[model samples]
Target: MSHECTTEDCRNHTSTYLCGRCTSDLQQWLDKVPVLVRELSVTVARLDNVRPAGGGGGGGHQPGSAAPISLDALQLQENLRSVGTDAKAYAQDSRAAGLAWLIQDWVTKAELLVSGPDEPPINHAANRERVRNIAPAMPTRELLPWLRQNARIVVTSMDIRNWARRGKLNPVGREPQPTYHPHEVINAWHDTRVP
Candidate 1:
């Protein structure tokens, strides 16, 4: 007897419950399960290697010291725990069991923990003043090319303009094309590119 395949998106008829095409796709998906599991194990090992930002092992203080945990490290630990929980939940789910999203989230959190904000976050005004005092301002046109050549990173003129508009990048001069401090631009590049 011929009947429609049980698999979604499959319209072929089969004597058995699943059509040949659907069975082939299911076999391919099953074959990927081992690879995904191995990748997840590697990710767990990498996360285990993630230590506190400072020279400390667990927290930001010396080993066996009584110093309180830094807020940044604490947040990192929390994020890691959340990732672990999410991974377990994904494993338990029968459908949509891909690990790519979980791995990406873990990587993003790890990056944040490694390159988090400066201690006692600086205010916008103080940051602007510090940038001005450190280096001379350069117009966007000149700065873009210089950054690409020196920093070996491609930061386009439009990126600088958009960052300035969004208040992510600060400018020194307001007339014509806005000028940005060299150090500020470098810092921005490091923040975004370093990982």
Candidate 2:
């Protein structure tokens, strides 16, 4: 969906609430902004607001004194501060939107894990043991490639354990933290050993 305005006139329409035409134009303007520009706009606004306004005007009322900052300058400074705050907020909002997309992707993957048919049945420990006995000897360099090709469908820890129990693949004997070849894990889903 898009709104209607074609020119900068919509910028002013911010306060009035853009009519359908200008709303579309303004949206197009926003869409074209690079993400870096959006982030930088916030940072620049923040820096300008905190800097001092007075400089270069010296005076001694009786012996020595400096003039107070002008009210107009102070007002202008406040306006700049407000703009910076708005930029920071926009940057945060944009980041949140990006994160939302990433989370959605993660959720979809998790859903597939729970709902897909390729997921192994959880109750068959004996079948898992049968698959495990066929696992090949480890410490061999060929293990990684074999597992990748044969066990490509093995998706969970239980799948690996089942393959190992059946003796089709052997996990490396690392003390306290053994790891197995990726392909050996994959071969388990075929209801056979890796050889």
Candidate 3:
């Protein structure tokens, strides 16, 4: 089950597309994206404060009349914009590489993440009918709200719904909206997250 590492010029063999070294490198690059965005933001802000380039010159144009923007500053602003808010949340991804990408829209001077991009991808919606068909029971509506309030951050409605669709969760509601028994959701959520 071994194959060549997907990264260019790396000869390591691994079952996954990336070898351990490349994955580590990519993880580090992702970790730096937020810092790079902050620095570029400061650079752009600093550029805005300087006098316009044509200032102090008598070239038939008014001095300090224009915004003080340089090519470097423009590039910096572009870099900042490319970081996209989704990538900013990498700050808490110590658990795994489920998300995180980009080497230069935020990167180190020496290396780039192999799959970095401005926007994070979106998953296709799970089939409602399929999920409904698989849910285990018709739990009371009262439990659904409670589960949502309790596990709002960890396992969202979509997560449970999708899990049920894939047979990971045997949700307990017949509603098209896809409700779950509190106990089932929590147990399943815990199992999926830990190990």
Give TM-scores for every candidate, taking all chains together and pairing residue i with residue i: 0.31, 0.20, 0.34
* Better model by lDDT: candidate 2 vs candidate 3: 3
lDDT of 3 by residue, 46-105 (tens): 643344554544543364576564445445445545643433244334422333334443
When sorted by TM-score, best at the front, the candidate numbers are: 3, 1, 2
Error of 2 at 2 (Å): 77
Candidate that would win on TM-score? 3
lDDT tens per residue, model 1, 118-184: 5886364565456557657889888777666654568878777777777778888979868987667
Write out the backbone clash pairs for model 3. 102-116, 103-106, 103-107, 103-113, 137-172
C-alpha local distance difference test of each model: 0.55, 0.42, 0.52
Candidate 2 C-alpha lDDT tens digits along 21-131: 443433343332343233334433343323323444334222343333333334433333332212223323424233333333433333332233475665445544554
In angstroms, give how far residue 109 of model 3 lies from its true place. Answer: 5.4
The deviation in Å at residue 106 for candidate 2 is 48
- For model 1, the superposed segments whose C-alpha errors exceed 4 Å read 48-195
**Cα misplacement distance, residue 194 of candidate 1 (Å):** 24
Each candidate: RMSD to true structure? Answer: 14.1, 18.8, 18.0
